[model samples]
Target: MRHHVILRVIAKLGIPFIVLFALYVQFHGDFGPGGGFQAGVIFGAAFILYALIFGLDNALKVAPMNLVITFIAVGLLVFAGVGVARQVSRLRRARRQFRRRTASRHPARRARSRDHGRRGHDRDLLHLRGPGPVAVEFLIGHYNYWIFIFLMMLGFYVVVARGNLVKKIIGLNIFQASVFLLYISIGKVLGGTAPIIIDGGGPVTYSNPLPHVLILTAIVVGVATTALGLSLVIRINEAYGTIEEDEINDMDQEP
Candidate 1:
């Protein structure tokens, strides 16, 4: 069969279920591995395929760039905003504790000194040290979520602020890459050996391995999504003679 003919058949037969399955995976992520990032790409791909078969205009009408951009930004912001909120809450709690400690004591100066001592101790508790593999692993796993948040913000800023289509795609890639880091970091185990088996009779502590496998799949998916997104950008530029989003919007509005 011709490529277009096959695409039409696939579009008719597969798009609906593909979308449904994407939603399933998205919601099911908390229980298992798959999550919003994977599901969004799959959902995006279904529409992208439709766009390829029917036309960009029709697909955009179905899922406008503005809406898709909103989806992307909202997902990232939810993730990062949670981290920022947590940090803020922690700081507030610390301040409250300081106030209570000072108020509980009769002598304010001694209370202040005691509060400062407690604050220093709290800082020390937060200070993560190396040397122990387990400690390092714990620190990395704990902090990876924050790193993911930062990366998401960076990616969203790039996508929203940049004019170049390629740069936007790069931002999208970075956003996806951050999630991959999160998954992989969580999978790490202290003193865990590599997945490969050694020839000699050596003891080995293996990591969960699931996160690594899942991340590998995610990386492949990310690459495919990025390629497809770039292709669409190229097509958009070809059809409209400009890839700058603002220019495209203006062109669409021109009567």
Candidate 2:
């Protein structure tokens, strides 16, 4: 409340740190293990904490719904549109390169081109050789995978089965977190270091960085999704005076 001095004082003292930690996580991830999504969540959490202590009305005044909505749209368009544009342009470029390859009539060149194509098309996820008969020990070694799978299922169940909107949101967050865990798990190496360059370090084995980059993108998406969801919850509370899904449905069904 406006009159609650203790809360106001503490929030004043702690909010900055929350925001700072979030910033650190976001920017520092590039070198160690931080990224956009983790940053976004921390940023969002700061606001959520502010709302909890300072009141939702104050939070809205600080971060207007219109502004939030505008940013959500802007972020979605920039992220998704850029991704789509990049994909389209890359495909077109690849097509042009393929045509040039096909135009060549040399047999040796053709064979070499075919082999090159096969190698180029090969990817970590999709390989000519399959994962090839998973072993029990191999699966057991990566226990994080199992943990994420469990969290994902739990989150999915809550989101789908619960009637309480807040609980559903919690579940959605859990689901998203589990997905992050899954990505991080893939990037992790059994005995590798962070993908960082050292001045004198030689023959440094490191975890894959690709998944971290992808997770950074996913984090941005997650923040937008979470913000949108919370905004919807606020509107639902205003409209129906309750955020329970069943209650909303009953109200809608009533005369």
Candidate 3:
């Protein structure tokens, strides 16, 4: 790798852009597509590329193990902090609304609040009725769900049937992708645009952003899982001279 000057130079040039893209994803996630997990993976990947090109020792020098661990802890804290902040904000809003309603001396305001609550409950009940009768529109609209099911089953079959460790990891990734697709499909609403409202925009349906956010976390987890699995496979290969599950089992049975 030291002799590969062009490769090293290209990596050096590309790594910064990769990192910048990751930042863009992290910051723009709230308004569009991207999130913290995706950003973290991309950031980590830049380091990984650097390691592959410059050697592990150099990579360690650039990002020490202690520093990596610290960053991971900080990330966890940030995620937890955001959740805590949101929960606290929600509680405060609820408390303020309750107080506002209680402080109102007008009977009409209290009646209106009660009526609104009843209407909300009724809406929930109506939702409980579930999907309407199946039709061509429903089937065509749910094509993404069908893709999810197919990928899920294919991945499941591969995981169960394949004897190679690498194949198993690939299957897991496929399964993870299926889950991502499912979440994205669930988030999308027909005729809904991105969840953004312009000042002068008329009433518009917005796709749910929560599922996309959650998927970003899942994507990070999937990346970590894949990396860990591959690392383990490498270790297993070094120990047993093969990555086939059956061969490994046979070797273990021999002694």
Q: Kindly list the per-residue Cα lDDT of model 1 for residues 1-255, writing each as its tens digit.
A: 235777788787998998999999899988675487789879878987788887888889999899989987998899899999877778767878877876643242442343345444223434566568967775665676678889989998898889889899999998899988877766565676654444574545555566777788899799889989999998998999998888999999998
On TM-score, the candidate that comes out on top is: 3
Give me candidate 1's TM-score against the actual structure: 0.44
Cα lDDT for residue 167, candidate 1: 94
Question: What digit string (tens of lDDT, one per residue) describes model 2 on residues 1-255?
Answer: 768899889988999999999999888988774577678778988998899888999999999999999998998899899989877778767878876875753333433344345434322332234364554544665567778989999999999999999889889989998999988876665587766656576655566666777787787688778879998999999999999999999999998
Residue 152 lDDT in candidate 1? 87
* Higher-ranked by TM-score: 2 or 3: 3
- Of the candidates shown, which would achieve the greatest lDDT relative to the real structure? 3
Write candidate 3's Cα lDDT for 161-229 as tens digits.
999999999999999999999988766656767765466766555566667778877987998899999
TM-scores for all candidates: the values are 0.44, 0.60, 0.70
In candidate 1 the C-alpha lDDT for residue 111 amounts to 27
Point out where model 2 deviates above 4 Å: 1-4, 14-51, 56-139
Candidate 3 regions exceeding 4 Å error are 1-3, 20-39, 81-141
Candidate 2's displacement at residue 196, Å, is: 0.9
User: Using TM-score as the measure, what is the rank order of every candidate, best first?
Assistant: 3, 2, 1
